[model samples]
Target chain A: MDPVLLLDVILLLLAVTTAITAMAIRDLLGSVMLMGIYGLLMAVIWADLFAMDVSFTEASVGAGAATILLLSALTRTGTRERTGGDHHLPALVVVLITGSVLIHGTSQMPAFGDPQAPAHIHVAPHYLSQDIGKVSQKSSDGATRRDFGDHVPNTVTAVLTAYRGYDTMFETVVIFSAGVCLVLLLRPRSPLRREQADE
Target chain B: MNIDGHLIAALLVLIGAILSMIRAAAGPTSYDRVLAVNVFGTKAVMLLAIIGFIGDRSGFLDIAILYGLVNFIATVALLRFVETKRLT
Candidate 1:
């Protein structure tokens, strides 16, 4: 097997193992730590796939912010999980069904990195061609005026900011709202206030 | 088969990561698990840097740096959480 592909397979298998163990473990602290390992594995996988932007996001958000947030939550709640009856059978059946359906859905999709894929045949070519800096802006009378200087070379950034501006805007809004909610929920208690109340 | 040096390096780092994962999953002590996770993060940073070389893209190094910083912060947070019951 190709080494890069082997690396991908190993990382993915490790991720699945950590994920399942995280769910099955009785110790909540261990489970959370396993989740941290899983996040790092996923970030590596994304980097291996050459999706650096996504890898960066996973590194910062998945392995960083998420682990800190979960640890804080665990601080409030005890690290030991309460014993619950084993009811794995039903969940296993549901997971199997969902996995099969998703796998079946993949059959109709293009192969990995297929240059002739529909996505590549459409506006993607136009967007990629913009790297040449040939993009021209039209004046009020519909005549091409000045060349749009140095069209963004990074296709991912261009797509996020230019082609799909509204989508990216909404995503930022969602993230901002999530941060606001976290601040409201997890803000530190004022030590002076508590001391005064005790007095 | 022609083997790339960078791939070999990445594979080695990946092996280290898998071992760390094992320790993280089944470690007897919470500190052991925490250390395992931190080790895994370091391995991940190394893997990313190696793969960046293989791909000939400088952008992967940016991600490697991000992972490195995050790993440090997360390890400190986990250690603090273990030492003290509260994050504050």
Candidate 2:
């Protein structure tokens, strides 16, 4: 087997192991730390797969900021394990069925770089070949030119800040709402007011 | 597929994820469970990014970024709420 293919297989196995261990650990704090390790390893995997942008985001948010926040929460609430009932057999069966379906579906997917998939054909080529402009005009040679109006080369950025701007706006609002909800839920109750009411 | 460096890295991450999941399952305290969940979210973000790379869809990076931001903000909010609950 080629070295690259061998490497890919190894990575896949590693990913599986991390997932299993994360689920099996007993100590919550230790588990959280392991999760951070998992994120970092995942970032490395992304880099290996040539998804640099994704690696950046994962490393920053998952391994860095998210872990810190979780630790803080742990500080607020003392770490103690809780006993629970046995796993439901029906749920396990359902999950197994779903997994099988997904695995089967994957068999029909296009190979990694077949070059004929719709994902490669329709979107990326247009962006790569054409220059940004206001009018979608064809050149004398019959090639198409895109209207950028002031766009960056990063297609992801264009999609987020322009094509899906409205969605992003709503997402920001959602974040704000979350903050408000936290404040409301966590606010201290008034002891003096309660005493007066009792009188 | 032949085995190599990327695959090894993936294996390590998967092991970590499994460990985190176990912690989540066995957490004696709500905070521990929350922490485990947070870890899971982080691992998920990485997994998404890795999948995008493997699939050669760099465009999915935007989704990963958005997800990361959301996960971080949610974690922070949860922590703050927990603090308040403890104080009260």
Candidate 3:
């Protein structure tokens, strides 16, 4: 077997195991830690898949920030989980159905890194080429002229910051609002409220 | 496929990661779990480096560096929480 493929499979299996164990564990702290492990495994899987940008995001946000947030929440909510009914048959069936549907959906997709894939047929070729910054202009006589491209060396950065700048900006805004909400929700109570309560 | 040195190293690190994950899952104490998670994070960094080298994508090292930093900060935060029971 190819080593990279072997690594990918192992990492994915580990991710699944960690996710299941994290959910099934009764101890909240243990569950949170297992979730962190799961995140790390996912980041490794992303790396193995050659999605380095996604790997970076998973490693920092999924593994790091998420763990810290959960741990903080655990401090406030207590570490022991309340015992609930153990019947999970319905949930299991739903999850199994979803998983099979997703797998079936992937069957029709192009193979990984296939140059002839539909996704590569449109704007992707231009994005990967040196003509990214160039724009074609039509003359009055119907002659098309191409402007000189700025020759952005890093296509990923150009795509993220230039082509999809608005999307990235909105994503940042969403994350920023989430952080603000967390702070607003978790901030210490005002002294005025404590004084009023004392009265 | 013939196994190369980098592949062997990755396999060994993967085994270590699996063991650490088991310890993290079957922890008799919170400290054990924390230590195990820390080890797991370190192993992830190693895996990223090895995989990056194998793929000939030097840009992956930047991600590996970021992951290393994040992992250390997370581990420190976890240790502090375990020690004090308070995040602040």
Candidate 4:
């Protein structure tokens, strides 16, 4: 295997191992720490795949935000998982079946880094093309940007902010709403105010 | 030097991350797990930087910097949670 691919496989296997270990551990705190390790590993895997923007979000949201959230949740709940009772055989069988099906599905996909892959050939060339001087402030009777100064050197930023403008906007709005919901759910009640109201 | 330096650095960081995961999985106390997690987080930052150098894209370091900041904040949050039941 190529060195880079070898690295990817190793990192991916390690991530899976940590994830399984996280699930099996009885101590919820230990499980949380193992999950943090898994998230950090996932960030590395994403970087290896050349999706640096997605990797950045994974690092920030997965390793950082998720770790803090899980830790806080542990504090609210007890530290250890309750022992015994639940059976694992059925869940394990379902996971194995799903894993095999997914593996079979991936075989139909193009090899990693295949230049002729539809994902690369379809619209990527157009996006990468430098159309610097092409212009008209309102050729289509709608306010739209012409080719500005440069083709966005980083296509990730351009695709997120330009090509998928409304998609990104809606996603951000959804995230903000979730944050507001969390504040509403988790915020401590004002004890003195509640007491005064009762009287 | 060639890209080998960056590749070597990345490989070494990967090994370090794996070792830290073992420590975390086997740790007897939450404190030990926290220490192991901190090491793993640092290794992740180094790995991202090394991969950035290998790929010849300086923008990858931008993510590494974000990871570094987040790792520190998460470690602080974890420690605080351990010290007090409430993360306030």
Q: Candidate 1, which segments miss by more than 4 Å at Cα?
A: A88-96, A110-162, A187-199, B1-3
Can you tell me which runs of candidate 4 are displaced by over 4 Å? A88-133, A136-163, A189-199
Candidate 1 per-residue lDDT over residues A26-47, each given as its tens digit:
9898887888877888888888
**Model 4 C-alpha lDDT versus the unseen true structure:** 0.82
Residue B33 lDDT in candidate 4: 91
Top lDDT prediction, candidate number: 3
- What is the TM-score of each candidate's chain B when compared with the real chain B? 0.93, 0.73, 0.90, 0.92
Model 1, range B1-88, lDDT digits (tens) per residue? 2357777777787788878888888899989998998898888888887877776778878888888899999999889999997677
> Under CAPRI classification, how is model 2 graded?
incorrect
Candidate 4: residue A142 Cα off by (Å): 28
Candidate 4: docking tier? medium
lDDT rank order? 3, 1, 4, 2
Tell me the deviation in Å of residue A104 in model 1: 3.3
For candidate 4, lDDT tens digit of each residue in A34-116?
Answer: 88788888988999899876887888889888988887777658988999957889899999999999999999999999999
**CAPRI-style quality class for the chain A–B interface of candidate 3:** medium
- A42, model 4: CA deviation in Å? 1.0
In model 3, how large is the Cα lDDT of residue A108? 91
Q: lDDT score, residue B53, model 3? A: 76
CA lDDT scores, all candidates in order: 0.83, 0.63, 0.86, 0.82
Which of the CAPRI classes, incorrect, acceptable, medium or high, describes model 1? medium
- Per-residue lDDT of candidate 3, residues B1-88 (tens digit): 3348889999999999999999999999999998999899889889988998788778878887887788888888888898999988
lDDT tens readout by residue for model 4, B1-88 = 5776766777888888888888899988889999999999889888878877777778878888888898898889888887886688
DockQ of 4: 0.74
Could you tell me which residue pairs clash in candidate 3?
none
Which of candidates 1 and 4 is the stronger one according to TM-score?
1
In terms of DockQ, which candidate is strongest?
A: 1
Question: TM-score (0 to 1) for chain A, all models?
Answer: 0.70, 0.63, 0.70, 0.67
